[model samples]
Target chain A: MQGTQQPTPQPTAYPATDRTVPTRSADRASYDKEIVHAILDEACVCHLGFVRDGAPVVLPTLFGRVGERLYVHGSTGSRPLRMTGQADPGLPVCLTVTHVDALILARSGFHHSMNYRSVVVHGTAYDVTDPQEKFLALDALVDQVVAGRSKDSRPANKKELAATAVIRLDLDAVSAKIRTGGVNDEPEDLDLPHWAGVVPLRKGYETPVADPLLAPGTELPDYLRAL
Target chain B: MQGTQQPTPQPTAYPATDRTVPTRSADRASYDKEIVHAILDEACVCHLGFVRDGAPVVLPTLFGRVGERLYVHGSTGSRPLRMTGQADPGLPVCLTVTHVDALILARSGFHHSMNYRSVVVHGTAYDVTDPQEKFLALDALVDQVVAGRSKDSRPANKKELAATAVIRLDLDAVSAKIRTGGVNDEPEDLDLPHWAGVVPLRKGYETPVADPLLAPGTELPDYLRAL
Candidate 1:
């Protein structure tokens, strides 16, 4: 009966903030909420940028999206995780997820670019302390990896939950920058003898590798079968 | 004739620094130079983290790798690019590249994790100003996307070269952390009904899409065709 509460409403678009706009290619920036969510949901990893002692440190970590917020979990001993739960007022973080769809090989090296969809989210991340919300966020994190996974897996026990730290950052200032389709070669460089095109990149799942100690006759679940 | 001089001798391994070690999962980290180079070379995009006004900012950008240096190019007017060239020494930056290999679904929520290979590099980036070195860096950038692309494409004109800025980060303090194989479920959770396995992720390149404005009779180059 838990985690069956009301769902968060989706916004069609987000308002552009000073940090969200692209300084290089302004035309490629997007403020569409759906676009931002889709990019965040599809990527399995996100680069979390946080300032430590006035220096920038970016760490790659697993992340999950639920409603309008992201849930990133780590061991209680992790630096950022420790900072989030114990630090007052939370820690400012910028999380970004990117999917490189293609290599845009242009006629000139100076024009080479990438066809990618990326989401950048800026906000202060607060520790999820409420048991109810933390439980739901944990569920969302599992389901984010494999849809319907939380229901199948054993829920976190009290001791296990206490050992983990989950941080929540709302999607208030978010932006999606996307570059789709063919190259943008200079007009004068179009007739160059070189090949100019997009080599599209696609991600697919291979056959599953089950644990060596799985009980005999344990069938692969439909959830993973689809992946 | 300038950048064609000496090929950097490949380092057998990188020395571990305090910053490169992982606190929570120390076993997964490695100072192997080969592992770091492989991860960086395979990924098409990198998240470049740098401080702007004392706040951390991470940007997804296309990158190229030379023997022991990484090349990231941007417009001459871009903030980070301008900062590297104008700053007293260079801009302190952390560049990270990651490849998500699989989703590890375990019997318990706390045990769920990802199989990934990621490289984190901490260094100061300086602008490549010498015309010879700059030209070669641009070539490396293009070659990183598609092998042999630099020779096939037209060389950059003086004006185009002037408009681009390339920064070099030597691979001095680099580390690669990789996690592979099946789920690490607890001994007690083995008999749970949930499926425990790894769904491997694979990246493949689709047929190259030709530019719509290509002049008639331009054939697909063998370089892209091979991909």
Candidate 2:
């Protein structure tokens, strides 16, 4: 957390906290704001963790980041959403997203690892109740999945909005960890005669399948075509 | 939990628990063992959630599933690893893995969602002690990333094994939730003139890059070449 940057370029690094730091391999942690946002934006789904019955439960859901705030949506009747809606202080939550970019094949099985980028945010999430903001946040969630699709799609009607639940968590406590590059074999194991390197995983968009019941002349829009 | 399968085909389902069931959208939850194993085997990383000081903390880590047992690795000094290793009963943890297959852009913003498959396991994670089992678990982890890379690579030495920690969790209390196919818009909104479809996301492996210091004339193994 001290002087993370070379001091030659980029802005100041993000402030670190007890929860954000990894007990081992502190060098891989980054509190920089840009790094946190970039990783958050790349992944479409996040793991939301909360305490229930003195035990921890993690659920996978979609999320969108706007500025320093992340908005997550769920069924209005869901436990987390319901808790956030009724509580005065909101519900404490830890949201995390990760992407495994490659498999790091080290010469030794002990050193086998993955090239990944992950972000963890610790904060309280409040149920968003303001009608205007809820509408905007819901739009952001859709656009988060496919840009320009929100505008083309119909806005939520009153009945639909009643069934949906949206919660917002400010990104005050956030940290990103990233691992890249080739295998890190030990000095003596370098000549082990085994092939060791990175097998990169790439995420790409495939052909868009139109709905089977689509009205006969509804062409694929330019926005989807661009995807 | 009651007669989940049809008259024929498939395997047994996990017993339902109050914690495992989704309070909302119960129809999307599946305790089918094959579905749970399929989702677990496909993902490389999982979110491990545990209670620390009566609060929730979730960590993203690599995991491999062998039959009904899941093994996760970490540095010996990591917090979760240390906690699991030192305890007699091990740490109570919830592990979850998710795969987002496609973006479901519905005509209405409320119905916009992602087609995803996810699995959650609630159990105690015990520290692996036996050397033979540890070796096999480590090999399973390597093979988890790339199917045949474990046998093709070098086994861990004594010193390497000493520095690594592995935890095993039983899959008795496991559940898989999946949403697939096209958007389910309301009947009235079906002809809204908006483009709605599934934009699939695919994961592909790029050409493997050999380590810069690889010994000369060391041919790329068939295992890695196939990847």
Candidate 3:
């Protein structure tokens, strides 16, 4: 079986383009789809950037991922959403998500760094037009917040769906950059009396505060309980 | 004494420009200097955006705030840093920092949201040339990662400083948007049997992992211990 096995034909990484490649610290950049997807899924929000009137604008917003596509939703009246819908082809955008895992404190200030995982996606965002696809995107967005949440929450009604606008960006040009492990202090600075180490940052959910208007018989959902 | 009293002349908020205002959720946007500063100080990393080749590009990087100025440092050869240095005018940029406080899960998918504080600055970033300003910026960058860290670590030497490039963006044309409190569900869906509420997210630091080659007698600094 080992000698006769066929070479794998599938591509497991996103094709690296000129835009996705970093000019410095190229060793930290990765095109691995698994690494990219994990970083994207773990992040709660994505900083979306787009050009308006020849100037760059960046905003933080919630996003959901379905396979190789990302869905970002906002009010139909939102400027970015309106532009995505009105543009001839689509709106060029860059979406980035970062998770800081730890703070690397070194003996030298120049060596201070962060242990982080970040994914950047450069693509054209098209407004979601199809009703069925929009519904799926909405469900994915709800589930992205909490696993199994889409089923638990009431689906958006026709009026509600009409009020929301969703833009879809395919994950074509994507790259993940990651830095991990401990402090890297130079030999000369190792004995400088500085306490060098890795201070890990952790994200945790505290007890959920039930809404005052919640139904009397409703119980905390298992999905949230797990968190 | 009452008749002689003079109104305070100092401005407590930033001047909001057209670009700083959100097209939607205008009510969430703030021009208060204190609000913007607090949000910026709490965040460790910021998503910086610039137009490259006529398309928007967003990358997450470490940043520090000193009064009204924000500084971001990286390798001198990095793409954005180089562009800021070479551009005739300063490079136009949009810097955004966001902190998610809680997840709002509602009875309906449409009502789901997040409680977050975010600041966005629209301005041109210029490369820092003055050696004194660069040194201060570098110190602020290190301190931004951990309070009092700049003093604890050795300052960058001449060669190290030469290898780093710092870009400065003034906190003009800045706005902060904040959302807080509980789920905002429609009255008709309040009794829909869903456990709607806010799940608070907390950021914490785990025990510090000392470097393998840390000085034998070095102790954890009080600044880190306080964390």
The candidate, 1 or 3, that scores higher on TM-score is 3
lDDT, candidate 3, B91-140, per-residue tens: 99999999999999999999999999999999999999999999999999
Docking class of 1: medium
lDDT (tens digit, per residue) of candidate 3 on A1-227: 66988988878999878888899888999999999989988866899999999999999999999999999999999878989874458999999999989999999999999999999999999999899999999998888888789999999999999999999999999999999988888888888999999999977789999999889989998898999
Model 1: per-residue Cα lDDT over A70-158, one tens digit each = 98888888978888865478888889899888888788777778888998888888999999988998898888888888998999999
Which portions of model 2 show Cα errors greater than 4 Å?
Answer: A1-13, B1-11
Clashing pairs in 2: none
Candidate 2, true inter-chain contacts retained: 0.85
Q: Which candidate is the best by TM-score?
A: 3
lDDT of 3 at B213: 94
How does model 1 score by TM-score? Answer: 0.92
Off by over 4 Å in 1: A1-11, B1-11
Candidate 3: where is the Cα deviation over 4 Å? A1-9, B1-8
**Model number with the top DockQ:** 3
- Residues B73-139 of candidate 2 have per-residue lDDT tens digits of 8889998888886447788889999998999988888888889899999989999999998988898
- Per-residue lDDT of A57 in model 3: 92
Q: After superposition, how far is residue A187 of candidate 2 from its true place, in Å?
A: 1.6
Number of backbone-clashing residue pairs for each candidate, in the order shown: 0, 0, 0
TM-score of chain A taken by itself, candidate 3:
0.94
